[model samples]
Target: MAVEFMHPDGLLQQSDYAPVAVGTGSRLMLLAGQAGVTPDFKPAAPDLAGQVHAALRNIIIGVRGAGGDVGDLARLTFYIVDWVPEKWDEVLAGIARAQQAEGLPAPTPPITIIGVQALFTPDFVVEIEATAVLD
Candidate 1:
C-alpha cells in the first residue's frame, strides 16, 4: 500500500476505479510500454484476447523485476492498435485470464486506453505502460 487512491466527491466518479493516485514510495518506476510479445520478442498470440493477456503478464514481469508486485502499480495505460469500444469485452476477458494464470491482484489503478494505428510491429496488437512505486 504505497499509494492513496482518491475519488473526490463530485467529479463524475461513477467508475469502479480511482481517478487520481497519490503515491508515497521513495522509488518510482516508469516502465516502458510492454508489448504482447514472448521471451524471444515474438508475438505471444494472434488475437486481441491473447495479446491483451500477454501484455498484462509482461507488465507484471517488469514490475516484479523492479522489486514490486501488481499492488505497487499506480497507473496503467493501454495502447491498442485499431481499438474500438466493442473490443472492450475482449480486453476484460484477457485480463481475467491473466489473473487466473499469473495470480495478479486486481489493482484497479487509474487507467487510460488509447487507440493507435499501429504498435512497434504488426505482431503486437497491444502495449501496456505501467507506473509503479516501491520501497
Candidate 2:
C-alpha cells in the first residue's frame, strides 16, 4: 500500500486534500460519515467527548462491516461543533482508544479536525469520516 502527497499549481498543500487518491493494486473503501446519532437518529450523548467516542465506535463498526479494520484506515476527517485548545487532549485520547481497540500500531492515520458552528442536529457534537486501504 502507498500514499502519495500531491500538490497542484494553485492549491495549498496543507489545507487541501488531493484531487484524486490513487492506490494501485490495493482495495479502497469509502465510509459514510458517522456521527453520535443512534439507529433512531438520536444523539448518543449530549456531551462533546461522549459524542466523539460514540462516533468513533460507529466508525469502527462500519469499517469492520466493510471487511476492513481500523489498522487499514489511512485517513480520517473529524467535524466538530465547537473546537478549542483545551479540547485537543480529549480528542486525541478518544482517537487513541479507538485505534487501540482496532489493534493498530502507533503513529495513527493522518487526521483533519474541523470546527463548525453546528451539525444537522443541535445535540450532535461531532461527526467523523474515514477512508481505508486494505492490502
Candidate 3:
C-alpha cells in the first residue's frame, strides 16, 4: 500500500503527524475506540503511559484481527482525559515502547488527538480509534 501526505502552503508541517493522508487499498477496516481495560472492565494500568501503551496494543490486535498490519493503518484518532500539552511526552513514550515491543514501524497515518473531561468512566484515561486498509 502507498500512503501520501500533503502539506499546503499555509498549513504547518509536522514530522510525525500530517494534516492529511491519501491512501489507496483494496480493503478498509474501521475499528471502534479501544481503551486500556481488562475483560472485567478494570483499568489495565494506573498511569497514563501504561494506558497509552495498552491502547496501542489493543489497536494492533484489532487491525491484525482484521487481516491487516501496522502499515495498513490509514488514520488514528485518540481521546485523552484531562489532556495537557505536557502529556505529549508520556504519549510519545508509550508509543515508542509499543513500537519496540511489537516491532511495529513508524506511525505513517494521520492522527488526531482530542482532549476531554472524562471517558466511559473515571478510571479510563485514553482511548484510540483507527481506520486501516489492505492492498
Q: Best TM-score goes to which candidate?
A: 1
The local lDDT score (0 to 100) that residue 119 gets in candidate 3 is: 97
Which candidate achieves the best lDDT against the true structure?
A: 1
lDDT by residue (tens digit), candidate 1, 63-120: 8899888777889899999989999888887777787898654546787899999999
> Residue 113 in model 3: shift from native, Å?
0.9
Best-to-worst ranking by TM-score:
1, 3, 2
lDDT per residue for candidate 2 within 1-135, as digits (tens), equals: 444334467765543234334344278887887997788989987777667677878877887787766666667788987787688777766666655664443455566889999888788878999887766
User: Residue 109 in candidate 2 has what lDDT?
Assistant: 59
Residue 110's lDDT in candidate 3: 78
Report the candidate with higher lDDT, 1 versus 2.
1
* Cα lDDT tens digits for candidate 3, 20-123: 76778878788999997776778889988888888888888888888787777778898999999999989887777777886445644677889999999999
Worst 10 residues of 1 by lDDT: 9-18
